[model samples]
Target: MTTHLPDAAPTNWVDRHAPSALRPWLKLGRFDRPTGIWLLMLPGWQGIALAAAMESRWPDPLLMAAFFVGAALMRAAGCAYNDIVDRDFDAKVARTAARPIPAGQISVRQAWVFVVACAMISLAILLTMGPVAIGLGVASLALVAAYPFMKRITWWPQAWLGLTFNWGALLGYAAVTGRVDWPAILLYAAGVFWTLGYDTIYAVQDLEDDALAGVKSSALRLGDAAPKAVLGFYVTAFVLALAAAWVGGLGPLFLPPAALFGVHLSRQAARLDVRDGVAALALFKSNSLAGLLLVIAMTAGMWDGPASAL
Candidate 1:
């Protein structure tokens, strides 16, 4: 029996929503896939929550909203840029052949225009943040611009992704306090490792295709040891996240959620079959749940009082 790859609904939806001329560019940015947006937003929210825990205040709703909008636009822009750069490579992969650039639905020049439009929207959101947050946000553009080429040069493009994705942790704290601190750094590191583990699982689905295309990935690097590597990364992520919470003085309510996150990670590691692409894609999508669970844990930890705190 053959397993079908997960269909990208957003790509399809965007294609339907856009004009015939614009559909391809919109699809390139994956406006229809909201999971990437959520993944991007969570770390920023985590940072905001950690700051709230330290200050004994609720996380700022306005800041949260801004980060949410910023995340969506930036993620879309990133996708467009990636598709444009990887058009040839994406065409070669069965899973990505339908992408706008590879399908010749959009030109590279058109994609650049779309990227600029998205960046303008992202910039509008950034201007609302504090100077420190703004600086961090500005710095991320370099990472975003460079990411598409990392696969061609390094097997560890996921590490670069970790660096790019978790930047919100820094921005969130800076938005709240206008300064960088140890707690935010710890949370950022944890987010990086978490991304590393999940993205490695995602890469597993493309292992054979990636190998044939000469693409590098952590999944390819680990081979049979991928499961164990995932375990190690998750363990580190949990430990670092816990340490960040502790440093932020988050109460005991965090312990239960953290423990639950550990269980989830263990389940993922135990169930993973690196050689099974369909199974790998399922497992990769499951990380959205894992990430949300950890966010819940973090939120509870931040909300739970000192008396009931772990």
Candidate 2:
């Protein structure tokens, strides 16, 4: 007997007011899932923490707040753009069939207007940054606009996502120091690997749907050995993040958080059941914890000051 689980009830006020057609668009961009925003925000925090280590102060709360808001707006914009581009493809995939445009809830023109409004809000936030940081923020638009197409042409679209999502690390450093540094680059690279790792796990949920629809992904590319690939990516992310902290001149307190993050990644990899979509999603969401742990570690390391302060 097939047991039918009820459609998930929408809980938020925005979700309720969302045009029935726009609902899928919002869901497609993961407005329902805040984890993507958290992932995007963490790299900005890392940059802030690294900058604080350089200045011998806690990271600026105002700057962090700006990043938080900017990330939310920009991530939403990116999602709308992606859905507009991928609407047909999304409709063919079971996992994405109900997306706003794919489900006939929102028109392409409407999605475009939504995207533009979100971009305007993001740009306003960007203006609050220094000229160099603002330029970096604006430059990121090129990457964002092109990302929805990368999956059509390349199996490594996740790499493109890494480049786009982690741009905040560079912007964070620039916002504080008004310049980029090796530590920020390393942190950004680490975030890229981190994104690749988690997003690949997320892709596992759509593997069959993707295969049927001719969609390419790291999960499909790695095939049965996806778990191993995830492990390698997570390991690289951890190593690069440690390099970023060291280059930033953080103190010993950073080690505990770093160690804890490593443990957490390993645990996720161990518990991951690639064949189960539910399990895959659960593991994927757990990455927010991984990102948070690193932020805490980096924050603590910056707070204590470098050895010179002692």
Question: Whose TM-score is greatest here?
Answer: 1
Per-residue lDDT over 213-275 for candidate 1, one digit per residue giving the tens place of the 0 to 100 score: 999999899998999999999999999998888877787877887798888888888888886
Off by over 4 Å in 1: 1-22, 303-310
Measured by lDDT, the strongest candidate is: 1
Q: Over the stretch 191-291, how does candidate 2's per-residue lDDT look in tens digits? A: 99988988888888888777788888888898878888888989999999888887788888888988999999988777766687677777888888998
TM-score of model 2 (CA atoms): 0.91
lDDT of each: 0.84, 0.82
RMSD of every prediction: 2.4, 3.1
Question: How many angstroms is residue 39 displaced in model 1 relative to the true structure, after the best TM-score fit?
Answer: 1.1
Candidate 2 RMSD to the real structure: 3.1
What are the runs in model 2 whose C-alpha is more than 4 Å off?
Answer: 1-29, 303-310
